[model samples]
Target chain A: MVNQQRFGLSLVALSCLVLTACDHNDNDEPAPMPPADVSYSYEVTVQNLTQGQPLSPVGVALHGDAVMWETGMPASEALEVLAEGGDNSDFIAVEGVLASATGAAPIGPGSSETVTVTVVNEPDTFISIATMLVNTNDAFAGITGHGLSELEVGQTMMMVLPVLDAGTEANSEAAGTIPGPADGGEGYNAERDDADLVSFHPGVVSADDGLMMSALTSAHRFDNPAVKLTITRTE
Target chain B: MKLKQLTSIMVATGLTALSGFSQAAELEITVQNLTRGIYFTPILITAHSPDQQLFNVGEAASTELQAMAEGGDISGLETAVDALSADTVANPAGGLLMPTAATTTTLSTMDGNTALSIVAMMLPTNDGFIGLNSWMIPEAPGTYTVYLNAYDAGTEANDEIRGGGAPGAPGLPVPPPLEDLVGNGGSGVTSEMTNATVHIHPGNLGDDEAAGGMSDISNTVQRWLNPVAMVTVTVSE
Candidate 1:
């Protein structure tokens, strides 16, 4: 009788297990499935070429059909903030960005950093990267709205980028205005005291160049094509 | 005899069709001043043969180039290129191309003339001019953009004062539009042409004092970076 009882209980348990699985299948709603994984990756390496200026944390973005800044046009507030303050948070978060990456730390003069970004199957995307020359008020260097759709995996593209004036702040180089280690005074003041249109940077006029109030020296001076960028599509 | 004549005529037609390598190109060229405060005097755009060059860096400027760089004169260079059978558009802007202004002209380039060059003087400087030297025209049909830099003709000392526009003059030639805008100088900046060959300009050094500074140009207003102008070429065969 005991053996028969054990057998009966085993049969009941098996029936319950089968019925529960059947009930789960027969339910009106099914569990949600995870989406497919499709990724396109790029590795961007930036080199700071200035003698005294340390570049801000580099921000690289992949977008479609947009320019972050243009010559003769007013800079967007995001660009102004980055140009003035050496901050890239707001710039990277600007709308219409598909994928983005930021360097972990500021790149010092002659130093380099690599930041990798991944997007979902966006092989035909335009890439823009920007970083501020930390010694100046509104000088930044990068390429904007450059087409990278033709760059295939394993192919590398290299460019020497020219410095551009954001035209948001005057290049006063005053003692208490520069944000770099040379001054350590201020960054990202909201005043638009200079020409509001973007242009190639005329370069900084340091104290050595007869600007009385400038805190910068001749070592802080820089010319065109301030930075070099190397980009490779990974996967 | 009739069949042989027909064959010869077909052979001639085939040979004519295969000789399409020297086709002419129609180009619409536009130059836009990208400076904030500088002005470009009358421009000279030319399409010439590959072996010819209006100006080359590291070489001394020709007298014709010096004339144009100092005085905004294109007639001398125009005459020289005309002798070479080049297609040219002289003074497309008709006068000074002001800051951030653009001017366009069309030219039909003849066969074997595949290079394009452009030159225009930048005002308020002794001999600074925007130059595009011997850029090869593309055979494909498309629009191409090029950025140009400022070059010093090394013909005159950059004495930032008012003076004559002659080829050997020392001071900047202040036009009527720039008379009051430029300053009066107490003394000249320097009486030397250091490089004495066509090279990149060292840019202007204008002080804030309008009447008594070493330079008459404005330090803040008249300064510019490289890539002073943008040229676009639209080509169609």
Candidate 2:
């Protein structure tokens, strides 16, 4: 009688297990899936290497495939704004920008600033940074669309930046036109003057060099490689 | 598969032995002037032993190098390199390599010649020249590219005036083509070479006035930054 009673209890337990399994299959809810993994961040440090020219507030952006500027090509409207007036608003809001960061203040000559920007995406991303030499008419220095796919964790790359002219404005060195402390004048205008294609800057000819109406002096002059940029992949 | 691997090894060994037997190499070199306004004086391309240097930064220049940097004379440097049994080509362009121009030359380097150097004076300046210091030539047969920068010999003052081309001269040499471009009758810029050793050039301080100004160079035209020339070398197997 005891063995029969135990057999009956075992049958009841099997029924309960079969019923639970059927209930689970009949439910509409799906199984729990693994979590999605996607994210990236970079730390960029820009050092002003000039003697007297202070760089404007930097504009940093992360994108997938678009370039901010190209050598021997025309500067886009976003680049023109940043190069002329030290305003990075248009550049930060550019299309394809995954993330953007702007320095709180202008980086002075011989000083450095670090900016951090993060994006939640795959590893196939690029970073671009730009800033104007606020003392000059249209001179700016930065890099565009540097690939970050191979930047391993804790890896850093150092690049020397060459000065470029935004071709949207003339390098007239006229008074009341420069936007930096050298002139405190107008910044960006829609007018397209000079060569329309971006090219290496031919340096500024200050008033000391006979640009009589120029707000700049000999001290504002600069040379190639006006900025040093170091980028490190932190995460 | 085993036979294929053995054949590959044998070919590699044969090639290495052939390279060891052939000690001479033929090199085809092309140099491009990338600037828009600057003029490169007659260039001297030399392939010498590993011990020689055409120019050294932060060091005092030899008299031969000074002559080429201050003036557009390569005779001194040519003679010096020749004394070392170096393979050299002088003035491949036959004259000034104009702005945005290119010149090419071919040289056969004998055994023990392993390094290469090129030098050319930049006109409309006092002591500026495009320099490629001693660089090792790779033993592997391939093409290589090198960018050259302008260097100041620190031997003469950069007065930026128009005068003569002789060694130890006071001012720039007005070549025929550049005479029309350079200004005239300018007061001197300076008469001092502050750092009397090879250093980066403190670029030209030009004036706008074409005639009768503080500088014979046009501020808008005569200035340049680093990397004035691009050199391409093709090594024959």
Q: By DockQ, who's the top model here?
A: 1
Residue range A198-218, candidate 2, lDDT tens digits = 666778888887766678999
RMSD of 1: 11.9
**Candidate 1 clashes between residue pairs 3 or more apart in a chain or in different chains:** none
Per-residue lDDT value at B41 in model 1: 92
Encode model 1's per-residue lDDT on A120-234: one tens digit a residue. 9676788889999988888899988988888888999998987888888888788778898889978898899978888777777787876667889999988767899999988
Task: Return the TM-scores of chain A for each candidate in numbered order.
Answer: 0.84, 0.84
True contacts reproduced, candidate 1: 0.19
Q: What fraction of native interface contacts does model 2 preserve? A: 0.21
**Lowest summed-lDDT stretch of 10 residues in model 1 chain A?**
A22-31
Q: After superposition, how far is residue A182 of candidate 2 from its true place, in Å?
A: 1.5
The clash count for each model shown is: 0, 0
List where candidate 1 sits over 4 angstroms from the true fold: A1-36, B1-22, B99-104, B176-181
Model 1: per-residue Cα lDDT at residue B143: 97
